[model samples]
Target: MKPCPVLSIALALALGLPVPARAQSAPGQGGPTVIRARDDALYRELGGQEAIRRFTDDFYDRMLKDARIAHFFDGINAAYLKGALADYFCVSAGGPCDYDGVSMHNAHAGLGITKGDFDALVEDLQQAMDAAGLPFATQNRLLARLAFHHRDIVTR
Candidate 1:
């Protein structure tokens, strides 16, 4: 389904807000060009902060109920996890949310999180995004941002 017109406009504004000069990109030859901060287009496309919060909430709810990944959440504070995820997504999507959670490395350190578990988490997140009816581009954008943290979160 097409996004609502109002959301489309908010996305544009959220992404088009002037970024700092240091965050600007220099012209480069072919291949992917990197922007210092989060991509505004992707952020706007994701429907901004409220959408992110909804996505995170739904994602965690699914994770908690899924037998495949529920074990990983054992002993973890569900509320705290949800709050941290909200903050993380907020920052990751170029919103104004502040993430005060421990660095990914430190947070997952000694948790014995294997690559398989990490992949499962990604799959579940994808499922959650799809269930939320987000566009594919927005899903990919969020996934790409989260993928960078795998190195720090996965011990194996």
Candidate 2:
């Protein structure tokens, strides 16, 4: 039995790649029509590299100002953090970039991050996306993908 296209798409997403196209039977018994999932171009829709940089910058700015999560970044270099995050987010969003930073688990290993902290950070990120004028749906799509990393992010 052949696997469903949905499964294929899920597999691609799990691998951090673009969603695969699905073949659906056309009307009137015509040949199958290719249905390309919007998720495949999510990185581009999120405005590619420059947009990710701006979004990352705004996010860190808010994070630094927010008392709830500010201490987590205390004494950290903002410029370097922003660049590394831009690369991380770009790759996570299926953009044309590679992330060479430490793994999420290894990076946050001893941060003592709690669920509340993670949730608050997510809130800050959403606000940053809002400030950047990213469409709500697109923001949610990206957030959903990021949410999958929660296990690796929160150690407390």
Candidate 3:
């Protein structure tokens, strides 16, 4: 079998992918983010699932090392998160992948996540995208799709 990746939305918020594992999370309790993709264009630009997996791998490393947000991932199974996150991103990018993780709201409930944390997470994601060699316009396009998820990740 192919090697799977680590954690997500912070895994994606970084895509707020910093939720508990499927066994521990609410398991698809919340609604999905509806992104109007122009027919897999974004997915292709993102280099497909392989590219996403690489970006996610780097993204998780960044989050775990960042003092500003690493605490949130304590004891979490990053491998499991990475798979779910890739699917979320694939779906967001218009690929034919199924997102089976919990809702953004459900994933981050009671985490006391603040706007600052969300921003930090997004920053890390941007850096990861940059490292992944994603073009400026392409990165912006993807980020725009994920922007709405902020409300769910950074609950007051």
Best by lDDT: 3
lDDT by residue for model 3 (56-138), tens: 88988999999999999999999998787777777777777767677777888999998788777777877889888887667
Superposed Cα deviation of residue 4, candidate 1 (Å): 28
Tell me the tens digit of each residue's lDDT in model 1 across 30-57.
2112222444665677777788788888
Query: Can you tell me which runs of candidate 3 are displaced by over 4 Å?
Result: 1-28, 33-38
TM-score of 1: 0.73
Off by over 4 Å in 1: 1-39
Candidate 2 per-residue lDDT over residues 62-123, each given as its tens digit? 99998998999988988888998887677666676656556566667789999878867777
Q: Candidate 2 overall Cα lDDT vs. reference?
A: 0.68
Rank order (by TM-score, best first): 3, 2, 1
Better of 1 and 3 by lDDT: 3
TM-score of 2: 0.74
Error of 1 at 78 (Å): 1.2
**Clash count per candidate:** 0, 0, 20
> Per-prediction TM-score, please?
0.73, 0.74, 0.78
